[model samples]
Target: MNDDMRRLVRVQEIMVVIDALQEKIASNPAEVARLEKDLLAAQKDADADRARVSELSKDRRRLEMDLMGIESKISKYQSQLLEVKTNKEYQAMLHEIETCKTERAALDEKILLEMEESEKRSAALRSMEEMLERKRRETSQGKTRLDAEAQDLMRQVGALESERTEIMAGIAPAYLQPFIKVARQRKGLALVAVRDERCGGCHVRVMPKLIQQVRRATGLIACDSCKRFLYVPDEPSRAAGAGAESPAQ
Candidate 1:
């Protein structure tokens, strides 16, 4: 390849690398978002557990208060038993006392159950909080690593872009303009090597005459099918005469 062709190849190479780096850089935000989303989900779960623990605590307090009221009623009923005058009145007072004890026993059972559940839920909440803390730490570390990686990629792209600019300056407009136009049209692929008498970009058969012209390296020559500039490899065997066919238009 001539100097212009070599520069074009190098520029394409640099641009391809730059494109890949920029793509990775672009994806950094989405990766960060995904990490944050996971952390947020864990936080939400921890919050729900805390709310449940609070609710259980409230229920336990309410049950304890109800139990206290029942105990007071039982004490009042016992004191009234001493004031009864007749045996029939005494029996009625005893019945009231027995009814109060039954209600008190039921309340005690409910309070016990509530306290047990509260203990269990509180334990679960503690465990969830520990997990949330760990997740937060991991998310922070991951974000930092991604940020560092994106910054590194940006620096590499900046360097490659500078190299591409220098290479572009060395190339004349006649060659540079076509390369730019074709690279834009073909996603940064404006030049390809001829292999097996085929256009490397399109894989279409290349005319023998055009292959000869590409081997001569006289001027910029594009593939008829894909419009990408073609070149022959710097090998003696491959650069041998293709045929004496008429030159391509």
Candidate 2:
């Protein structure tokens, strides 16, 4: 390939590198964000579980207090039993004691049921605590991995950038802007090879005149169909950048 084709090919490679770097940065940021969301959801679950337990405990205490008050009333009624003198009064006291005992039976059962439910709630809370702990650890691990990868990518970018600057110096400065514009529009694929008389960018047959001009390599040439710079590679089909076949006869 001639100098013009070579320049375009180098520019294409640099754009590819930059795009890959952008994707790497985007991917890591997304991972970090996803991990943070996981941690937040787990924490919310733990909070809700704790709140449920707290509410149940308060309810249990209230039931116990009511039971105690009922018992005290029964005690008062019992003390009154001995002080009664008439048969009618004694019978009335006996009825009142029976009624108190029935009410106490129901209240005691309710307290027992609440205690059982409270135990289950405590178990659920423990499960939530465990889940929250695990989620936090996972979130931390994800961030650590991202940080390490980011550092490595930065180092690679630094080395590649130095190489890219050197390559850019070899080409005329006037060619650079059109190169960047084409690369951006074409998904980092500004340059393509013409093989088998087809425009590699569009896989379309090129006009005889266009192919004639491309072979000269005097300046950048764009495919009419895809508007990408073209060169004739030695092979029928080949990838561009960092590799090539010697131009065919």
Candidate 3:
């Protein structure tokens, strides 16, 4: 590679590094945001579980109160049975006791069902709480690591920027503009190597004359198709020994 090509390649190397660091820095915030969202979602789930258990507990309390009221009514009816003056009165009092007892049994059954649901809800809430704690710890750790990584990437970007400035100064003004323009347009790729007699940038077959020019590094030769500058390495020519005896296979 010529001095200009070498310098441009160096600049490209630095730009690639800088671009990667910038991307990582840019993406770190998004990752942190995602982690925060995940943590929030877990907290919401835990809160819902706790709310469910709280509602079930309230229902259980209401059922117990109803059961107590029914019991009190049944006891009063039983006490009135001793003072009943007629068979009809006694029968009516006994029927009232039986009705209260039935209601009490139904309330007891409902209370039991509510208790079961409360127990399940409580267990689920506990599990969710544990999960929430774990998620919180994980999110915290992830943010810490991401922050550290972002800091390191910024440092690397600073160093690469300095190196890029030096390499840019080494390139000639005539060659620098095209490199910068193409690099800007092509996502930091201004030069490409010719391989198999094809343009590496667009993979189009290069004309023989242009290929020879690129190999000689006579001047910056742009690809016919992609218009990107071409390069050739210092490796031996593929056809240098084609007419000689073939090596033993």
Q: Give the Å shift of residue 153 in candidate 3.
A: 1.9
| Full ranking by lDDT | 1, 3, 2
lDDT of 1 by residue, 142-164 (tens): 99999999999999999999988
lDDT agreement with native, every candidate: 0.87, 0.80, 0.83
lDDT of 3: 0.83
Quick one: best lDDT, which candidate? 1
Clashing pairs for model 2 are 194-231
CA shift of 92, model 3, Å? 1.2
State the lDDT at 74 in candidate 3: 86
| Location of the lowest summed lDDT over 10 successive residues in candidate 2 | 240-249
lDDT, candidate 3, 72-139, per-residue tens? 88888899999999999999999999888888888888888888888887888888888899999999
lDDT (Cα, tens digit) per residue for candidate 2, span 1-249: 565456557667766786698689779988999899989988988898899889988998998898898899889989999899999999999899889889889989988998898899899889889888988898998899899989888778788778778777777666667777887798878888887789888899998899888877667788999998887753325334333443432
Poorest 10 consecutive residues of model 3 by lDDT?
Answer: 240-249
Candidate closer to the true structure by TM-score (higher is better), 1 or 3? 1
